[model samples]
Target: MSSSSQGEVVYTPQREARSAFPMAAILLVLGVGVLLPMALARGLTTNSELKVVALELCLLGTLAVLLQPFWGLVLVVGLLYVRPEESIAALAGMRFTLLVSLVALASVLAHLFLSREKLVRTPFNVMLLGFAATAILSTVPNWNMAEAVLEISKLVILVLLVLNLVRTPQRYRAFVTTLLVFTAYLALYSIYLYFTGGAMQQGELARSQATGIFSDPNDLAATVAAGLALALVRARNARGLMRLVYLLLAGSQVWAVVLTYSRSGLLSLLLVICGFLICSMRRKAISTVLAVGLGILLFVVAPSRMTDFDRSEASANQRFWLWSDGLQQLYGRPLTGIGYGQFPEINGGWTAHNSFVLCFTELGLPGYFFWMGCLYYCFKRRVPKATPEEESEEEKRDLVGARLALSGFLFSGFWLSRTYVPVLYLLMCLPVAAQIAARGRPGPQQVKGAEWLRDCGRIGLISLGSILLIQLMTDFLK
Candidate 1:
């Protein structure tokens, strides 16, 4: 058969073999886990409170991770080991999107249902539930369903994709490489928008604003900032051809970031760069001077369009209206707030833009605070594990570089909730999980029942969250 006729992409014999097992496992798991909850809960009347039930399900699903870190690790590592996406696109075929989405869904479902695998707990699922909880009890129609499906689809894909692709440091590097390539596209796209999209506005507070595909300069900048963190980590540790490639790509991504007139993104990027420089443990004095110099340069060279962002007039004004209206609704029913995903119903789907505020509008104070607490738990709780051969020169360089990369991500996440970005999700989770796996366990060990109780607690929270979604799904007005 002609090579072209056979299709340009073909996998090696081994790749074809490994892909089948995980794909099937994912399907079987989701069928039993998520859909079953919907079926059993079908009789519940959809109402503002139903959204809360859905939120409970998300929480339960997420907490289910605590019961099975090893399983979570398996899904994550398995994803890396096989990397079906790059090997043979045909394996996923046209259903690739659904395929990955289902993997994400299934992983969570598996975590929740696999009572035997208490070690399957994962922070990713915890966050997924908490994020979903924000939309519980919303008056908005189908808000619970959309957010639930989207949350499951994304988190599932994230867990499956990263874990499958990141089996080793080398595999982790490949993931970063793919990410850098994507960043390059973002850079080029930003260039396209800078020159053509919006007429360059003058004397605006957001003067240097650079909007690309996102239609918002800030969002575009934020995305690139994230890519830069990964690129920097890879560039620092790479060698030979790969090293040179990573450096060039990282540099390109940084340059692209400068073009986006996002003050906040630049601020976040600056913090990441400086954080890495400090974490690198280079001579403190020199690092200080260098960081200062770089900061000055950034300030001087910030985009001509950034003037618009300075005032925050557009952003602040919109935020005020949303907040005031949201407060009025939330205060009336302070405990439940508006239903999960109900923020749109409040003001026609205009986001609070800021994620923290977004939670408030959708979930009110109770749900918002609970969600934040979970996020805090995930982000703050991390300890890098020991690697073998740290005594060697190359290994030391690697150790330092990996930490720097982690620093970049940690610093950047301060500016945006990266819990969802597929690349960012893996970049952060892979290393953190590797650290835990290397330790031979995740966190301090406790008795089996204690762990079960912990998961049970999460299940209770999520089960209540499920009811929240159900309420939203059933809200009589809608």
Candidate 2:
């Protein structure tokens, strides 16, 4: 084929015939080589034989990891959703964690020595390293040092991988696209569960809680809420059929979140919807009407078991007690509290059920500062503000969506203990990555030390304020 016009391809008869010949040869080879083997060689059919085949496939995957380390990062992303340990507990069990660890090791090593380019030491990079240090040091006083170190280390590795590897807008977009596609599967599955009433029952509600990485309906809802945020932003930027597809995806995710029966999930979705109304769509009248209708419908349709605020329900009483225990722990040990992941042991075998409470009680003051500082940096740092004409719409939408998603997460944290969740950290890293990519090269714009310190101070005040607010709520409940 040749170009008849500057940007157009002209297919000639000779070129078409040549392509047909290659296609014919490929089909002939596939028919003879593939079908002949299947017809003559009867493939292994027993359980033992399948195990052997799985082992061989794993070996081939190992070879692929060795050949292309970046692909290892992509695999890790997929595994985060598939969560083989939970999704295929009967077969893979915790072996998936081992696989991810190996892949992480390879990817980091390859990035360090094999790749010519090095990760830029931006402010975000420093903040992440500081957060990692804080997590490690907090473990020094941990109730279970080994467990804290292992879990926190895994989280840190995932965060660092995103911060270091995703260095361009294209790479950032690719990750978002991959994430959205994976979450689309979750959205569809949740919708299916809603229709089929396949969700697990908890208390008086039939909740669409997921197993594996997300343990409860609230966590599942948070995941969907985050995806909904991203979809809203992308749909705003998309055109024609693509826009319609994203809008549909967003709608499905909203329905899934609603099916979870999690107040936190519903709140997260509301935050994103409000964000859409205010930031981009500006459908104020529609938003107002929808908000009012949703409020009435929730009260009318939701179970009295959940809606009762008189502390008559089991979950309400449980959360109140958990929050009380966690707050008491924070007050008792303000500097270094009960230690990371120790709330369950101290709080009647239940999580703090509040992210800020979990941080304050578990990590104590230092860890709280570090953790909140990371979030504050993301929230406070201005997206590299060039003129609207200068900024790419993709970058603009990404930053907006990330902030909205973070808002949803923080809002959900009032009821969900997701302090160490990888999804939250991943969302935090996105704006940092997008800003760096938009700048196109290393520059002074990448550095912001003083602002980080300010965020730490602000977060400290916020932590104290949160404690007082909880105290007032506790007193009121009493």
Candidate 3:
């Protein structure tokens, strides 16, 4: 298949011959035919029946993935974000996430090999691989090698799946829409939890929490902040009813973040809003007015604790101490620090509570460069410029939304140790995915030799500056 200059894929005869099969339908029929009688049988125990149902579902899901890998990508994403195991006791013992992700990875490999499709390359690929390598290398003497390996594997699979599956504009939109829907659900559910007194209490504050990775109120707020940014961008680019839907989602996410009462969450939300306004090309006056109004609403509705930055605040003081300890560890081993996943163990059962510090402390300068480089390139637009008529509005919206989401996450990460989170990898990959969907291939230019050195230097300087700033803040707080 060849791609047009306009990014429309043109399939050759061989590629056209490889059209989607009816395997999913056949699998569905077979599963129902076999499981229906088993489920109806009165001789089966409850445990046996549940196991049977789970088996049938897994069979169907695996078949679907083998036939259409994009569905598998979506399913894996859903599993990661929604985490049914946490909510459903039955699923807790099933190892469903690991099984589905393995199947998805296999499917992606088979599809790429069979279809002769080139792996879509991005500017961040090298840095990401370097970061993964560093993780593996740093694991040699780490106390938690197994956990570190698992986290690195997940990150790699997440990156590969996004790069390979989201190859078209239609798929990109579908993927993003799926994320927005999931985010809306999580946000609304958190809101529900708050009102129903199901919220979790941190100290004296009752904070809203969602299932899965969002169980932490701060993480929930940060995720919602990213979703809100994307929703705002989509709403700006959308028309009619779809615009209304996105706007409502954005508003709900905003309120949900406030309900979390996370100080970092509030900062992330503000950054997202500011990003939207800055990236926005039209209706500046009206957008500014709406943004101001939103800010006021957030302030009015936000819990008083959300704005508290007292020097004596327990959490804030703990973070400062953690940062200080993390820096000390990095100093002890500048080139190769402790090891990945060793921070909590070495620091009296406390994490760095800062992503940057986590990277420098755990994996050292090399790892820190790779990790920050991935984020650095995320903000850099790699797609070649197109004429106004040739530019896809949807593509533009997707790119803007990806950067805004990353901004929110990164700002929040300054106060959270999320270095290995799948959400971070997903956010980093979205821009590259969008670019590939728009351009139909990797850009011609690759950063190499001198340019690569320059970028490395810049990342190093940034890392140094961040460390110094943290040190200053810690000292001032003391």
Candidate 4:
């Protein structure tokens, strides 16, 4: 054959290979995709269970590789072809924390284009902008631009996930229960630690900390406090043994929180409890107040078990100094507010631990308001505004999830609170947004399922992108 003729003739083997392997490849891809989230979601039972689960997933994932190996190959291509510069949204894994943020930003831009006005008016958005600003400016001075970008991205992914997964009550309940169960386990572990672990009686402010499953006692206490608060909200809708289990979980967590000797956690727990009581049925409010008063009196009338308040004298001062430094930076760069996470770039002055302060320093007044405003909007008087006949199932679920999510958002005071755990946060909040989205929109059975799938695709891309990002920025996280 002539050279031109030979070149024009397609390779039969390559064509056949593509045709033969498509389904297998798709299958393999699906298997790995499913396995990743499942492993991430239910991968850990206990420390021991974690290993077993990993092995199980590995075996299963391998089977998928054998059966639908092409799918895996396809996924790899999709990942590379889709690349970060192509879209702010990444492909794979359904997660909402990051998606919501991108959407909100788009919404703001859209509003400006259509109505010629600013979309976000709240102060907290300014704070977020500040954080972003700080992170960016820090990038120029420090060679850790990659790390800072990844950190902010992780938090953004978290917010996106919260918006997506929390669309239904069932999912919302599952997420809440998951947190409670994990917290209960930690609470039990903390009890074990209290008995078996060593105590520090004289290391000054940081001495009397409770170390649970985690290395840091403050982290453990903070986690326990958040769990207890979340459990209190969850138990209200439960029944019989379910309620009992949740109450026990809450109690254990409360006990764990007390043992941590973290005054920040104590204050957070107190605020959550007070909020819980206020949200309770009016008739029960009086009794709850009286019981809570007695419980406090018993605990803190004098030197009690939860008296770690006297400690951490330097912690607040340190944070104050950090805030002061951050403020100086913010004063200079008010519009952009330094850069996203630039604080550590200049010197180790510690962070403006308070989210409120961090916002002012990093992104400035505008970004700060937008972030806080979202919270304010959610926490606004959730009066039963809907007529009995008007509210749809999705709407009801969204409202409920929103209330619970608001609780979680507010509980971020004990430590640095951003959307680090994207999946967890999205699972917690998606039900509310979904429920709201569903009220005005309804469909047939097959269609709704398809909608769910599409929703997954949307969130998955963002989440998958986030996971990839996390893997990419291991150095920063470490």
TM-score of 2: 0.81
Whole-model Cα lDDT of every candidate shown, in order: 0.48, 0.68, 0.79, 0.46
lDDT of 1 by residue, 346-439 (tens): 5776754444444554566556655544433333322224423322443344434444444454443433433334444445454433333222
Across 332-441, the per-residue lDDT of candidate 2 in tens digits comes to 88887677767887656788888878888887777777776677667664422335344576677788887888888778888888888877887887766665555444
Candidate 1 TM-score versus the reference: 0.58
Worst 10 residues of 3 by lDDT: 5-14
Candidate 3 matches the true fold with a TM-score of 0.88
Candidate 1: clashing residue pairs, number: 93
User: What is the number of residue pairs that collide in model 3?
Assistant: 0
Best by TM-score: 3
What is the per-residue lDDT of model 4 for residues 1-478, given as tens digits with 9 covering 90 to 100?
A: 1111100111111112333356546655776678666665554653555354544544454444344332222222222222222223222233222333444334333323443322212222333454455555545644667867766665543443333332334544554555555556667866775766454444542222333224356556655666665677557756899888878877787667766666555665665666566555466768577658955863574234345443245655455556556656766866665655655555475655655556556555444544443344344322333344544543443354445434544454424423233322333333334333333222111213554355335433543343234233322322
For candidate 4, give the lDDT of residue 51: 53
Would you give me the overall lDDT of model 4?
Answer: 0.46
User: What C-alpha lDDT, on a 0 to 100 scale, does residue 396 get in candidate 1?
Assistant: 42
Q: What is the clash count for each candidate, in the order shown? A: 93, 0, 0, 70
RMSD of 2: 9.4
Give residue 142's lDDT in candidate 2 (0 to 100): 47
